[model samples]
Target chain A: MPLFSLKKNNVHQTGSGITPIVFSHGFGCDQNMWRFVAPAFEKDFKTVLFDHVGAGGSDLSAYDSVKYGSLDGYADDVVEMGRELDWREVIFVGHSVSAMIGVLASQRAPGMFSKLVLVGPSPRYIDDEGYFGGFTAQQIEELLEGLADNHMGWSAAMAPAIMGNPDRPELAAELTNSFCRTDPAIARAFARTTFMSDNRADLPNVVADTLILQCADDIIASERVGEYVREHIPGSRIVYLKASGHCPNLSAPDEVVRAIRSFV
Target chain B: MKSSGPSVPLSDGGEPNAPAEDLEDLYENAPCGYFSLSSEGLIVKVNQTFCRWTGFSKDELVGRRLRDLLNVGGRIFYETHFAPLLRMQGFFNEVALDVMTAAGEKLPVLANASERRAQNGDVLFTRVTIFPAAERRRYERELADARAAADARNRDLTERWVAEREQGELREQFIAVLGHDLRNPLAAIDAGVRLVLREQPGERIATVARLIQGSTLRMSGLINNLLDFARGRLGGGMAVQLDVSKPLKPTLQQAIDEIRAVVPERVLQMHLEVDVPVAVDHARIAQLFSNLLGNAITHGDPLEPVNVDVATRAGQLTISVANSGPPISPAAMETLFQPFYRGEGKASQQGLGLGLYIASEIAKAHGGRIDVVSHANETCFTFVMPIV
Candidate 1:
């Protein structure tokens, strides 16, 4: 494959520092999700940002249904990307489901990532026996149906124009105005995978020094879920933020930057 | 600024003097639900309309987070997509959500939210409006289903088209190989027949050998036509090698002579007026002429003389063959050059119906075309090409 074709992941890197800080975005959005926080560390670290295969300016054709059928496939990409960039002692910061993806990647390649910061992380979304994951099975199904309903409007209005200019920077900039615009089919699949995955069994195996940023009023991953993650992972610490939504990165970027700075 | 109409009474704050009770009434029972939430999403203020729609009193709704009234899925969407967008973009419009009413039923609504920021860039509160969308949601669901069905159908058609194209290419390749393989045996049989004829075998044996030779010649013509048809269908078209040094008169005469030997009783009148060193593919031209002559001999009235006109003038070459017979029907004329198209009521045993198609293809390869004219007395086929 050509070098540009690997831009299917749209990996972006900056800074002159030796320690690489790779930022992975959540389920519903792309790497632009980190715009408010990642730049804060650029002067002190080699800040890296990337979109997952099906999001943002990433090449949509690289999306394979079978490969992305589970979250493990996504973790494989992170590990592969680390190997490709030849980074050592990496600091991986992931938001939402990507937090769990970072955990999986660190476990897959034990010493590659040295530190992890999970913001509003949830090991599971659907509540299981003796555990409240913040949702029921039927409610997740309803969310999938709601996604289908909105996709009808979204694809009809935006897909053709966005698909026509995949490589245009102006188009990419325009897309950031909407922020969380994702291909509806890929969004639906990611939703099912993120909400349905059970990563509770994998948390205890994490060897990296981990920090969980728990935001108040985060309905997607509540404070209790964040605490649950901290309790399961050895040597992991949890900090409760005054910010109110799941995305403190956008709502309280200064607070998020402070939390990551103190930990790193 | 001056008021054009009667001056309205001003309040102490310089606002329009409307009835305070009416203003309160409008706020209490507006058509759509309206409310405001603190930056933390706790319901800071509420209208009676929103309270009534959710089956909750103002006292019950106030101070509760707006997400508490939503179902689990709606709550997740609010946190993940809606809240973040509202914070980053300052507004979100026409987002579909289901509010869990006090009666434990889902109320589908289209919600719009905008954030109010203070001068210091601190978010003071978020105002929201909600419209009942049960009917519209149902219609949207139907449209979504239809779009999904259309996408599936399009994918299926593309897959089938690719498979069909592959199968067609394989079939053409098979035909070309079959045509090539059959030639070696055919040449051997022709040579054997010629040796037998030269030895002057006994009369009955000689006659049988002559019949075999004729059959082999016809078979070879059929194979050549099959190969050309396959090549044309496979997108190579016809390949012609132009030889300017070779005289064209002998090639034209040879095609006529071959046709005459096949049908000795049919009368043919030839006219050739080419003397220039014409740049042309001699064998391909002869093949085209032979096909036209064979068609005329098979269809024309045997007693009538078939006219052959070959001439080069004005930097153009024109070869026309005219035969006297019954006029061709207009229906047959439309499909005359199409492959496997034989005339109506014609016996299938005469040929494979590819001769005219191959002849026309050869004409096209030479950057030329064949034209036809049929009248009450005669049907004519003409080949026209540039003499470059």
Candidate 2:
């Protein structure tokens, strides 16, 4: 109700730039994923990081199933946090599902963001005719069932594949730990909302200058999906990273940071 | 043995070449498989034992990621869980996964992996050990089957319990119907006895008629109590049909007269003061008064008169019956209104013990109550019902 709490919301603010850069982590992760990249901008820009309602150290009581059934609900939280911060021309950097959330938020309050940085974002996850969203409906349903039956085992199995750094198991371990710490029911709901959402229509409504960061060999968000996002959003730029996984922030943080710095 | 030229050869084992061959054979035929992967997860080297266990040639395994040898589910686990654990902790042990053989059949296995890092802190290689776990997989499947069986048993038990409860309800309904059906035949017999007594003139025949009439009335009381008890217990509760046209005082008088005929020796003093015509269940109120007066006639001191008073004040109809009698015990008074609770003393030694219970239930069905006060020389029962 107070926009956010320092302890419950786990909100941290740093840096000296007049316009702040807000980083929202995707599903299966927390603000800690930005550990390597966030510090890079601390010297020049005001950087903000907070865990979503049912993730990390944030207040789990803030999570409502009905309210958070869609990405628009999450977008409302971002807009509310912005209003509370009273910042103008802020840069919003969201990864995976949070990218669509930021898009929805900026559309609602057009003046809230000056630029958008969407890393490995997908507007839709299930494939339709003429569009390749990577997964089939049945596959997504299996994923949901898998998450329900063996949430802990699913976390252990999926964290590494999603992280995509089989060489450095530590990165996968970090992702698994992050996934395990999240509330499973909220995670399931968030997963459904994220993967089932079709926000390509909302992209045309976004007025922010967007940067779509595409990983070369991401299994989650393919290059075509990233191109789809870029083409829909007016004047949005697409930058392909040399990193080969879904999470360049953890695998190739230096590249991710340089890309953000150059665009912002 | 102590020859000076070859004393050094005697120090070595007699068959030194046997040890070299044994070491090579052990590497190729160990109980568990062993392999090594580069930092990129590409299988750089695999022992003969590992290739034989996985049904793959060394050529097929080399240059392929370890995950490629696993089934779809196991591949996901290897990439997601096993890889991360090895990277962070430098080793992971006892991970259960399925390996895909060259024949495409799956073999469940337990595996362990440890990371080898270069001097520069970069990953160099990963060493892995694998063991077959067919027995463990079978045990897990058995546990799942047992759980499913237990769930089915619980569901069966729940359904049976519901069916038994429904059967119990049907039995109660049958008892209620049996009690109700006995009433019409009993009334017909009462009317025939009355007709016989009116036509007969001889003193002995008249006495027989009176005996039959008394017995019939007692039987009627027992049957009525049974009907009310069954209705209250089985069919929710006793139902009262209020007749607004009936005069309250005359109804009370009729019940008093009926009780007096049974105990002709006991004198009954009746006082009725009612100016208002009240709405009440005529038959039930008559039954209520009869039960109270009969209880007084049976228990009251034979010498003392049983007094019956009926009055209407404001919106309340009050009926009180009082008689001089031995005081009821405290324990007897506690269970006085419970059905079929026959007492041990004078009041308990008679009747089926459902009279007062039916009376109380009737009063309740009319949204009223009956109260009792018994002390030395006085036992009083009061019935009160709201008319407006």
Q: Tell me each candidate's i-RMS in Å.
A: 5.6, 6.5
Tell me the deviation in Å of residue B322 in model 2: 15
Name the lDDT of candidate 1: 0.84
Candidate with maximal TM-score = 1
Q: Which stretches of candidate 2 lie over 4 Å from their true place?
A: A1-8, A145-180, A183-189, B1-35, B47-54, B66-114, B128-388
State the displacement of the C-alpha of residue A115, model 2, in Å, after optimal TM-score superposition.
1.7
Residue A237 lDDT, candidate 1, scale 0-100: 97
lDDT of 1 by residue, B6-36 (tens): 4343334533565533445565678989888
Fnat across every predicted model, in order:
0.45, 0.01
Weakest 10 consecutive residues, lDDT, candidate 1 chain A?
A: A161-170
- TM-score, candidate 1, is 0.88
Off by over 4 Å in 1: A1-6, A127-132, A152-178, A223-235, A240-244, B1-22, B302-305
